[model samples]
Target: MTAIPPLDPPARLLMGPGPISAYPSVLRAMSAPLVGQYDPFMTGAMSDTQELYRQVWATENDATLLVDGTSRAGIEAALVSLVRPGDRVLVPVFGRFGHLLAEIAERALAEVHRIEVEWGQVVPVSLIEEAILRVKPHVLALVQGDTSTTMNQPLDEVGAICERHGVLFYTDATASLGGNPFEADAWGVDAATAGLQKCLGGPSGSAPITLSDRAVEAIRSRKRIEAGIREEGDESASDFVRSNYFDLGMILDYWGPRRLNHHTEATSMLYAARECARVLLAEGRDAVIERHRLSGAAMLAGVEGLGLTVFGDVAHKMHNVVAVEIPDGVPGDAARGALLDDFGIEIGTSFGPLHGRVWRIGTMGYNARKDTVLTTLAALEAVLRRFGASVPAGGGVEAASEVYSGAAG
Candidate 1:
């Protein structure tokens, strides 16, 4: 029998659109021993994980917990539980993630209404409010920051509009969570979900979510107790949910004091998620956000100095990621390959309509730093030159250094 070649993972500087780079501490935490799912220590660890996520999300939602899947799983659980069939759901599309919201809402059989804008721009709050007032949706779904377009939709005003219209508000913060400012409670967000893979610096298995009382009430109204879990003396049944594994109601019961068995909790992933939150909160949210903000600004300036134009409105751009146009003569994919092969760096390409037209550079979580920014800029400049884009040597690195030094003073 043939044996697999020994996998030698080269050290990579992750400056990509996502899965930026996990912190060494988080990686070390994952290497620790695993415990039984129902062990007493495991239950205690579960409680700690909930508390850690609550702090990171800045919410007191008692139902705050980790879903045993990727960020999309948490998204599905929230949407499926809150949006019943025939309910009016309003989705505003500004980029790829907006399409994601619409797709999920469609599967829930919602009467979905959309107010769309161009790819690089976010829809105005007035337009969203007008749509909500006209359609009077039962739930309003939005993505706080759509990384595809490098735009962040202003959410505070929309939240207020939802309150006035009696519509429940839900948002996906998967890409923006720790690297940007997010106030789940203050923004009046009813339900929000995020992934550990991005700014959290953890593996992709666990998704952290927080739900307000109203969201809980909505899920409670649609709860279903499974046959195996139902006691013989129980007289009442639940309103059957659309999907079993993605059911938020059943998940809540499992995480609650009753501690019923659901999926075997991804123990290592949970530990990593907990540690990610621990590391971030230990440094304070504002400081961590500021780190990403500064690094991202430096990257934008550096890219511009290299004769590249950034995509989207700079004023409304996300703090951790930048999208830059691929120059006319440069082959985008080839340049990316050069960066990885020659510099041991990983950056990202755009998706769908924007693919090959732009490249996305990220400064997120543990990877948001001066050294990473400087290294990436230097490498990008060299790679673009290799592709005959004619970038001046040291131009990108020089501009980035200027930004960092100026900020220091």
Candidate 2:
């Protein structure tokens, strides 16, 4: 039998939509020695992480905690916990992730209703209000940022619309939380969830979530203390949350002062998530958001300077990713491969209506920097030239430099 080799991976600049390079500090944090789940230090670390994420989400909800899974897990937990079977859930579909929210709601047995706009467009708040008035959904599940179309759906107004309709507002901020402006409480968000992989600058695993009192009330109404832990007089609801692992109510207990055992916590990921928030808070939230905005602006300018057309509404595009139209003669996949093989840089391919038509370039997490933007643009220029596409010499870098310098000015 052949012996397995040591785990080693190639170094690539991950300028794709998600799972971008983790922060150096976050990586170091993950390597720290693990302790027992209920150990004092472990519990302290968990408490600290919860507090940190509260700032990250800009909310004071005591229920802010980590879900022991990916961003999708956070989405499902929020949906299943708050939505009972036969409850109306209205999802505004702007891109792929929006559909994901609707699908998750469906799995939770929600009577799902969808209002969609074209792929590159956002669902207007007025349209959403109209839908809310008509459908009168109990929950409004929306995606804050959909990486698929590089659109950041404006959420400020929608929250009020939901509030007016007494809808439990939940947003999946997996792709946009740290880098975008998300005022969970001020925006009247009843529930919100995010992952570390995007703007939080960590590897994907743990999902940070927050719940308003209204959302907590909704979730607690369906809480089922597991049979093993059921105490005398403890009662289970008729509409108990179906999934044990994705039950936010139980997960909240595990993170809360009670420290009730649910599952063995992923200590490394907890450390990673902690450090990710520490790094963000140290830089200050608004300052970090500005950095992402500047980096994203540079990347967008760079691509446009390369004579590439951007896909979607420029005004509505997220500050972390951009979709550029693929040149007519160049093969999208091959060019992406060349960028990877030759330059060790990874941009992303499109999905659905954009499969072969556009390339998704991301400036997110640790990769949201001036240097990464400039390097990606340079590499993309060379790849385009090699692929027989006409690209201006030094155009991408020069344009990006202008944005940086303009900011300085």
Candidate 3:
């Protein structure tokens, strides 16, 4: 066997869309020694984590818990458990993540009906309302924020619409949860899922999920215990879900009082997830949202000050990330590479329709600070100027500083 390097990675300022710098406390939590999955301390940590995520999700549901994978894993668990083979699912695709929701539903063998809107914008409430009235889907699965297009879909009215139409409303909050305003209960969301990587200020691994009473009822209808532990005549789902790992019913039992043996819990990730919520709740969620709001505004101002156009509908932009149009004279990928290689800062590249046309700059989680925002803007200005693009020397920094000053005032 060859001897390789021992986990030495360059320290980077991750000012991009997601997986942005993990919170120091979160990383420390992940470093704690492991214990047996069902150890008293371990179960206590899991219970604490569940309670904390309930606060984070702003819900009182008993089903709020953590899934053992990324944000998408939580989404899959909710969908496969809710959508039967022939159930109707309506997905409104406006950006990459929304399309992802639709695709996952399709793979679940849902009778999928999609309502489309152009990228860089959100589907209007009226359109969603119309879709609900017309198709009358069993579930309406949507994404609250799509990093690819840098837009936050307004979920308040849509949730109400789904409720009025007797549809289960689920949202993937992977990209917007902590830094943005998300009212899972107030908005009548039946199920919501998020990851630690984005606004929660942690690495990608644990997924926080919450299920309303209605959603729990829907999932329980398809519940099935594993055959190994099954008693004779034990009731199982009529049409069993295709996946066991993404099975929410079994996961619920594992997290519930039953503590039924499913997969061994990811203890380190559970610790990290708990700490992330602890830090946010300690700082206060409203205060954290205000911080992200200020930082995002600063970055937007800095980019516009550098004579770059902002992409998408500014009115609907997320508080954590911005999509800036790549200047015609500069090579988008080359400039992004320069920023990373020379400055050790990461800015995201766009995807799908906006690919090669825009750079997604993020001010989120632990990085949503005045200094982080200013550093990213300054580095971006330098990279653009180096690439022979016309940019003012101190314009970006000055504008961002002004935003900070105004915010302080």
Candidate 4:
């Protein structure tokens, strides 16, 4: 047998769209000793986490909880648990994640309907209302932020439209939740799912989710007691949720006072999720959002100062990520590699229609700091020059500093 080295990873400053640096406190929380799943402390921690996420989502829903997988898992759970076979689901596809919602709905056996705009733009509320009226869907699935095009779809009016049409409204907030303004209750959202890696400053294993009472009712209607756990008088629905592991009804029982056994909880991920919420709340949710806003502004100014043209409608761009057009004659991937290899910093590449045409730079989560933004811009300026692109000396950092200076004033 050959000897292998112990795990050691390079220290890279992540300035990409997601999976950015986790908060130091969250990392420490994950290292804490574990307790049995049913132990009082474990349950107490779970309850505390639920309360924290309620504040994070700005909702008073009692059904707020964590899903044991990534953000997509949360999305799938919401779709599969609520949409029965042959139910109509209307997804307004502005970018990639919206298509993801529609695809997940399709896999859940939904009769999916989609209305799409150009990739960089958002679907207008009027168009969405028209679609809702035309399709009369049972559920309206949308993405609050789609990183592929760096667009943040306006969701405030869509929820009201869904309500008027009696459609359940759900949004995947994976890339936007903590970094952007979201009001689950005020927006009339039926369900919202998010991950910690984007703006909550944690590793990407657990998903925090909240459900309106109406969404819960829809899920409960499809509840099924698993075979081994079936007791006398336990009724199972004919259209029960297909996946046992992703069953929100059973998961809710496990999280709620019922204390039913589902899967053995991911204790470390639970801790990380808890700590992520705690740190956000301690910093004050609005204040943390403001941090992301300021950081994003600085990065934008820096990129524009470097003579890079930004993609999409700047007015509707998300506060946490931006897409910059790859300068002509610059090998996009090669430049990104040099930035990583020489500066130990990592920015993102685009996806879908944007692939190889633009670079996606993120100021999100723990990496959404003035220092990180300035550092990334400085290194990028050097890389651009090395790649035979024309960039002014210190233009990027100087422009970024001006933003910070104005904010300080």
Candidate 5:
């Protein structure tokens, strides 16, 4: 037998820009004893999870449930199930994630129409509305927050525009779910998907998805199952839907009363997701958003006080993450490595044209606390000073402390 290596306990710190440290309670929930997939208690837990996600997504849709994968899986499941061959789909490309939506639409064999803008800027609702009018697509796909650019797309007016054009609005809220204000039903989001890794304070495995009646109808029309496998007089289903594993029609049945077999449920991930939702709900959705808002603002002020420029317009930035332009003559990788190795802090770098150009600092989930924010700022100032930058000593820490003090008062 091969020898198994003993695992070392993980070092704890606030995680920024993703997989933000999972809550201790959520980790404990995942440690619960495993139960049979069809056990009564397990089924009840499943139902409860769906209920929790409905509250988290702020939706009344009956089809709301957890997809057994990461946030991208939820996006794929929604896109693959909704768009048929040659269907028209409109995507407003603002960042890397916008390209993701376009890619998913292409995989669904949809004729994609894209309206793109500069990376740091968000797509105006009018631009998206104009694209909808021009393409007249059956589905309109967008991302609620693209962490790549640290921008949150304005969603308040998007649903109304889609409604006027008879287009179903779909959004990937993976980076914005717990930290930002989102209302699936109120925003007219026909289908929305998110992950637990960002601001949800849980491990990244399960993907929560909510579907409006309109989205469900579109999926239901294409429902199918394998043929030639039913007993005599069995009302076997059609084979209309493309992929079995990602088919939302079958997934809904499996999650619903039918209890049909799809993929085996990712039990631990479900538990983690449930606890994550429990944490958010217990905090009150608005309060959770407020916490993120304050944390992000503090981080922004601290970075600026250190003689750094924030990349995006402050008026439009997401409340959980911020992008800052790297200082000239400073090697971005070396600076990031110093923070991680020496200070045990990790922030992110960007993609595409932004590679090595900006530092994506995040104040999200478990990392949004005052101490974490202050500590990150302090360490960042130290690192910048080492790189010959003219940052005033203690400037970042002092600026962040003021934000915390003001908020508490």
Candidate 6:
């Protein structure tokens, strides 16, 4: 057998769009001893996690629970559970992830309709209202933030628009939930989903989701009995949720008081998820958001101080990530490599429409700190200078430090 060495990974400072460095407390939580899926302690942990996520999601959803997979898993569970076949789903496409929602809805056999804006700009709430008036979709699915183009779409008004038209509002908050202001109840979102990897300060694997009473009823109407739990005269829906693993109805049954069997729960990931929320809530969601705001502004100033142009509409950009244009004569990926190899700092290269045009720098999760922000800006200046692009000496870090000086909130 071929032998592999002990796990000694490079000491990297993750400064990219997602899967950023996790919180130390969250890591420690994941290392605690495991318990049986249905153990009393395990169930208690599950219930605690549900309540914590209710606070995290800013909702009073009784169906708040964790989907034991990545952010995409939570999204699918919500979409498939709430949308029956032939349901019309409207998605406002501002960036790549919006396209992802439309694709998932299409695969769910829903009649998908999309309203698109330019890649770096947000889709206005008025436009979404106009689309709803025109198409009358059953469910309005939107992305709170799309990291690919660094845009955070405004959902404040869209929710009321959906309510007026009797449409269910579901948003994928994977990239924006912990770092930005997301009021699920105030925004009138019927369903919402997010992951730990981005601003939640934890690793990817578990997806936190919440469903309003209205959204829960949508799933219950189409539930089919589990084979083992079925009685002799039990009736079944003619149509079942297409994917067993991604069905929110059965998942809810597992998470609910019935404690019915589904897949064995991911115990460690559950612990990590719980810890992430506990820390965030203890820190105060508003304060955490303000921290991200300050750090993001500092990063933006630092990048601009280095003579880099910011991409997208800054007025509506997500607070956790920023897109800076690659200068002429610099190879985008090569610069990223230099940052990683030389300075042990990692930033993201763009995808799709923004590919090779811009670099995505993140200030989020555990890495959203004064030191981490300054380090990234400093290292980026070095890399730019190494690539023969002229940059002012000490300007990047200086600008960032200036912002940090007043960032006590």
Question: Which candidate has the highest lDDT of all?
Answer: 4
Clashes of 1: 0
Candidate 1 stretches with Cα past 4 Å from truth are: 228-239
Q: Write the per-residue lDDT of candidate 3 for residues 65-107, one digit (tens) a residue.
A: 9999998898898898889888899999889988888889989
Candidate 5 lDDT tens digits, 269-357: 88899899999999998898999999999999999889898997678899999999999998999999889888988888999999999
Tell me which of candidates 1 and 2 scores higher on lDDT: 2
Question: Which sections of candidate 3 miss by over 4 Å?
Answer: 228-238
Task: Tell me how far candidate 4 lies from the true structure as C-alpha RMSD in angstroms.
Answer: 1.6
Return the lDDT, model 5, position 334. Answer: 99
Worst 10 residues of 6 by lDDT: 230-239
lDDT of 4 by residue, 321-363 (tens): 9999999999999999999999999999977889999999999
Candidate 6 RMSD computed on C-alpha atoms after optimal superposition onto the true structure: 1.7
Model 3 residue 92 distance off true place after TM-score fit, in angstroms: 0.7
Model 1, 1-409: lDDT tens digits are 9999999889888898887689999999999899998998889989998998888888989999998899999888999899888789999999999899989989988889988999899889999999998999999999988889989888878778898889999999999999888988888999999998888877788899999999999998874667557545656543346788888888998999999777788889888888999999899888998988999889988998898999998899998899999999899999999999999999999888899999999989888999999999988988887778878778888998999999999
Return the clash pairs for model 3, or none. none
lDDT of 6 by residue, 180-204 (tens): 9999999999999999999999999
Candidate 3 vs candidate 5: the TM-score winner is 3
The parts of candidate 4 lying over 4 Å away from their true place are 228-238
Show how many residue pairs clash in every candidate, following the order shown.
Answer: 0, 0, 0, 0, 0, 0
lDDT of candidates 1 onward, in order: 0.89, 0.92, 0.91, 0.94, 0.89, 0.92
Q: Candidate 4's error at 184, in angstroms?
A: 0.4
